[model samples]
Target: MDYSPHPTTAPSPPPATGSVSGKAVRPGDRIFLGLSRGSGIALLVIMAAIAAFLTYRSVLAISGDKSNFFTTLDWNAVGTEPKFGIAVLAFGTLVSSVVAMLIAVPVAVGIALFISHYAPRRLASPLGYVIDLLAAVPSIVYGLWGALFLVPHLSGLYGWLNDFLGWTGIFSYSNGAARSLFTVGILLAIMILPIVTSVSREVFLQVPRMHEEAALALGATRWEVIRMSVLPFGRSGVISASMLGLGRALGETMAVATVLSPSFLINASLLDPGGGTFAQNIASKFSEADTFGQDALIASGLVLFVITLLVNGAARLIIARRKEYSGASA
Candidate 1:
């Protein structure tokens, strides 16, 4: 053997045949890339088309509207002057969604934590399955249940709220039928709880094992480990889940229509039986509306669409900012 290596040399790498990371692109990968790109482009085209249609129809409706489209609470789209506005719809939609979020987020987070960290494996599996089943329950079924069962049973609770919190005005009740925005909010909270809980549970489960182990090694309690490690890692996910639930609550139609006594007037109290949401109004009026009325409803729908997009966009921004904190970047 020679004392020195006999002219050591590295083997040449394969040449790039197509657009790839210094390697030949496979047929399967190329096909998948094309399919994914096509799907993304198609989705953008569809969304743009919908926006264009809604804008056109909304203009047709707004051009003839006599009332201020943002201020007036009246919704007489088929009348001679055809005055309509989204003030009350906006108020009801915002208030009910707020109420639903306030009720659902904490409960969902607690349930999620219990299933992910506190519950035994034997108990968690069945509970998670039940939550999945609840999510699959149809909106129409929820609507019927809310209308028939929830509305009737909530009167006593409403009375208690009125007695205890009536001075706040928002919780004040006037002995009306329990078909109010507050009732709608409660129903929506129940409807969305399963979704939020499922998402949060999955997020919490994704916390790095080493982080939890390290916390325990440092003599941290289980609750402290969760507070210091699990919560920070899952904050973004919880926000995303809450936004998803809020979107559902904002656009819920049949359930809200069934539970709420629709009116054009904005009520001072959520417990009062008089308010309307965009989805409920659209579903109730679309079938009976004339062409102009349909256009007006479409205008209101456009507003709702814009609102939902804004909410989701804001959630995305928040998640993006906190992605590194959540260890997603890592």
Candidate 2:
């Protein structure tokens, strides 16, 4: 008689994964997936198309240059032996952007911190609203105001800087009108301030209540709590905000054109009036330039495009490096 216990059969293999079993996706999910993928592909295609166009135009312009396209300081793009270069443009753009960042970032952080952590709710809400409103103000308005009101009023401050810091060469001035790269930087800083402050304030407001409470429980002071918990969590966000502000300062055309007294010559001192930015140059010259001259401007535009990409790339790297401490990772 077969009385022995039947040999235990091995457990059935686990049900096939979603892929093997062809688990059905919801219609809504499938639609969303397709849309998102299509959007991403479209963005890449558009970017590639723009890059190709810029490259082709730039090659034609550079091929026609009579001098070193990157090093020459002349910008006579008219006659048969035409010459122009971006050396001064590059210098002015970088210097002005750097100065704007230096002036705007710390002030923006302070304003954000005050709004987020220190101000009474009554004051904070209205103040934040005002800052947001400032952001909505047009860049051209800022440019006009800068050129008319701000520049005239800045002479005294420029003189003060020259008196105290002229030996540094950067602050040295020719005692002329205050239409200089430094002034352009100041205008850019003002234009970008609302953006940085708004973004930073939002980030600071998003700090975990529990983390702040824990710091309080440990008898930490307000500043100490912020330094340890809030700042760490919001560092990446602040960086992103700064990068956004920088991008605005970089590609600003109307504002720069309206404010800057553009020239092809590079001045050693930011307080000097002789310098130009790519955006400023393009905006100021594009209308008057001939076909080949317009192509030259496009070449400069290509350089500006490359610069903006590099700035964004660097900002991404910075955010990624600090992701561990940022709430983004959490």
Candidate 3:
């Protein structure tokens, strides 16, 4: 009985609670969170600063007493009046970009498909590396190549197009040389091709292996399996890649400027040697431009910025929609 009474021991204390939900974060975690927030804020501030600067410069051009700021096709920034408008610039930009996309998209997708689905593993990696290298090459180099080499060789192609498609008007070429919108487009396509192909190939490779295997097990042909499993999954990615290429095509300055001879007129012919783009005009005239002329160029740049933003935004929306549809189907 004495032993039993001595056996009674003290009970253990209850566990300490830091918060109501019983969750505790260390000092390191809090510091990391603060750093992340700071980084985000800094990015936003930088973006805002850039936007403000561009807006300030552009307003000077837009609000100046220049005649026909939006309609005139002239780009004589050094002239006394310094009259100019985005009409020709916009046309050239759109024409070159559209042509580039037309040439690049198909080739890019095909190359991507071949690399992801058809090429041997060793060959695919090397080829992909080469494409990436192409993407990394400087724009100025492309410009020089276009100016010195590509333009000379394109005369034959231009002649063929003019001869066969002259009645269509779009391919009509009055100039004997190949330095035209079409040639610029072709050069742009070559420059942007690597980018589009690399993006597309990466996307296609992300397709689920199980889905591809399932299609194969169901006795589908290789092409059929790809059509069902790969292309569908990568459709959004392909669009995104194409849009990236389009952005590059649209904003390219040195290449277009070096290759294109700008005349202030909007023509329907893709073969026309006369047209300009905002970037090209800026690059061509910015150095010799006066204060007001610089402002005008900045204004054109502002317009280009807006256009690029709109295009990228539209592309994001399309990709988002495609993702939603894919999720629904799954």
Please name the candidate that would achieve the greatest TM-score relative to the true structure. Answer: 1
In candidate 3, position 247 carries an lDDT of 84
- The positional error of residue 136 in candidate 2, measured at the CA in angstroms, is 1.9
Give the top-scoring candidate (lDDT).
1
Expressed as tens digits, the lDDT of each residue in 1-330 for candidate 3 is 011224344244455543543557677867987999999999999989878999998887777736677788777666656677888888889988999999989999999999988999889999999999999999899989998999888877878888999899998877566778888999999999999999899889878789999999999999999899999899888998899889889899999999998788888887868798889999988888889889889988989998998888888887778767655765
When sorted by TM-score, best at the front, the candidate numbers are: 1, 3, 2
Where in model 3 is the C-alpha error above 4 Å?
1-36, 77-80, 320-330
List the candidates' TM-scores in order.
Answer: 0.87, 0.85, 0.85
Enumerate clash totals for all models, in the order shown. 0, 0, 0
lDDT string for model 1 (11-91, tens) is 445555565555766779889979999999999999999999999999999999998999998899886888889999999
Query: How displaced is residue 26 in candidate 1, in Å?
Result: 13
- Predictions in order: lDDT: 0.90, 0.89, 0.86
Candidate 2 per-residue C-alpha lDDT over 1-330 given as tens digits, one digit per residue, 9 for 90 to 100: 112245344344666454664678667877987999999999999999999998999999999999999999989889899899999999999999999999999999999999999999889999999999999999999999998998889889889999999999989977777889999999999999999999899889878799999999999999999999999888888998899899889999878888788788878889878798999999999889999999999999999999899888887787667654542444
Task: Rate residue 256 of model 1 by lDDT.
Answer: 95
TM-score of 2: 0.85
Each prediction's RMSD over C-alphas, in Å, is 7.8, 10.1, 10.9
Could you tell me which residue pairs clash in candidate 1? none
